[model samples]
Target: MAVITGGTRGIGLATARLLAAEGADVVLVSRNADEAVRVADDVARTTGRRVLGLAANTTDDAAVGAMADAVERDMGGAHILVNCAAEPAGQKAVPAPSEAQWASLASHMDTKVMGYLRCARALLPGMRRAGWGRIINVSGLGARRTGDVVGTIRNVAVVALAKNLADELAGTGIAVTTVHPGLTRTEKVDAMLEARAKAEGHSTAEVEASMTQNLLMGRLPTAEDVAQVIAFLASPLSVTVNGVAIDVGGGVRGSINY
Candidate 1:
């Protein structure tokens, strides 16, 4: 089974559905209990597989522990974890942010970086006991380039955290990896595209075209595209790839896949 944080919406939700379709029982972790339950039911119906939603604030230790306990009791145990919880990166594009800006950045770290750690710590004991597990931390392409300071720091931190976890658990049959998605076509991206189009006085199609021009594939990768990669990495098939970050960006310009 898989426990996917932030699984009520966007990439996390998509990943949960994909995993369920692939024959894995899934638990969708979210802060909103109602929304989580609603989406879980929808995904379970559509995929015809076992899927559940457990509400927990990832930043809260007691809440995370309770969620893990529920997962163990309801689904037997989590063999995979996909950490995708974080507040959306804000709109401020300041290269050199002020103190107030740093505070905003710090919130991202607290949620994206430390929140991931909380979930990992809570669920890892069960995984170690099972003697096989996969942890896929969702970072972003901002880790590869330098533009948004907050995005850079948060995403890079996730990569570092995943690598450390993977190495530390290397001999225990558990693999930890990170996936960096770039310009994925999700609801959030759609809203950003609409806003940019309005601001630029261009059609949404035009704005989308410009935004995707930098990608070698000439289009943004869909959420499912990224989700499939995560599901693969979360499965036994991912035994070979560990302690590394995999980019699912459809070949962003100047990106060297070493």
Candidate 2:
């Protein structure tokens, strides 16, 4: 079974759907109980697979623990964990950031960095008992580029956390990895495009074109595109690929990551 935090939308929801279609039961977790249950029912109906919607705030230790316990009791324990519960990044306006603006960094860290750790801690014992598991951290490309201080720090921290966990779990049949998705097409894209179009006095299509002009693929990846990579990493086929960051950005022009 797979437990996907932030599974009500975007990449998390996409991954849950894909995994369920592949015959694995799924638990969709989000802070909103109603939305979580609604989405889970929708996916379950579509895929004809068992899907449970769970409510928990990853930043709360007790809540995360309770979530894990509930999953074990309900689904017979989860063998896959996808940490995608962070707030959307790149929201901070950082032009000579004020002290007040700087304070938001801690909240980002608490959600993406420490929150990922908390979920992993709660689930690792069950994974160890099974002697096989997949832990995939849904980080972002902000870790590679600059400009977004909160995004960069929290994403980089996730990479570091995954690497350390991968090393610590070596020879234990559990793999931990991080995936960095660039500006992918998700539910938020339409509103974002509309706002950008209004700001620039251009058509939404034009604004979207400008955004993807530099991408080698000439288009933004859809949430499903990124989820395909996550599904692979969550599978036994990815046993040899651990502790590394995979970029699902559809290729950034003139920037090479070695």
Candidate 3:
């Protein structure tokens, strides 16, 4: 079974669908109860696999713990966890951010960094008992590049968190890894592009082309593209790739990650 936080949309939703289609019982977690159940039911109907939607705010320790307990009681236990419950990054850059912006950054960390840790802590017991598990952290390419300060920090922190967990869990059957997806084409990105095109008096296609000129692939990856990578990392095939961060951003031009 897989428990995916932030599983109602974007990469999380995509991952849930892919995992369910692959025959894994999936639990879609969101802060909003109605949306979570609705999406889970939709995925179940489409994929013909068991899918449950639960509500939890990852930033809250009690909520995360309760969610984990419910998953164990309702559907055996979670063998895989994908942490993607974070607010979208890309806040306006400031030379010196005000108190509120700084607070926002802290909130991001609480949700992305500490929140990942909390969920892992809650579900790890089942994994340990099963003697095998996969924990995939959904970080971002902002961990590699600059410009978005909050994005960079929180994503980098997630990488650090995954590495630390991987090291500590070495020799155990559990593997922890991080995936950094670049600006992928999700619903949110589509909406943003449409708004930008309207404001700039250009076609949405033109705006997208302008934005993606730096990509060597000449296009943005869809959420499904990223989900494929996550599914691999969540499988037994990923045992050799623990503690590593994989980039699923198609390809960026003129820069090398290594």
84-146, model 3: which lDDT tens digit per residue? 999887535444323337777889999999999999999999999999999999999989986
> Which lDDT tens digits does candidate 1 get at residues 1-258?
899999988899889989999999999999999999999999999999899988999878899999999998999989899999988865555565343376777788889999999999888998999999999999998898876778888999999999999889989999999999987889988888899899999998898788888888888888999999998999888779999999998887776767
Put down candidate 2 lDDT per residue, 32-100, tens digits, no spaces. Answer: 999999999999999999999999999899999999999999998989999999988655456543333
For residue 119, give model 1's deviation from the true position in Å.
Answer: 0.6
Q: Give candidate 3's TM-score.
A: 0.96
Off by over 4 Å in 2: 97-102, 198-201
The reply for model 3, stretches above 4 Å from the true place, is 91-100
Each candidate structure's TM-score, on Cα atoms with residue i matched to residue i, is 0.94, 0.95, 0.96
lDDT computed for candidate 3 = 0.93
Query: What's the CA error at residue 93 for candidate 2, in Å?
Result: 2.5
lDDT, candidates in the order shown: 0.89, 0.93, 0.93
RMSD of 2: 1.5
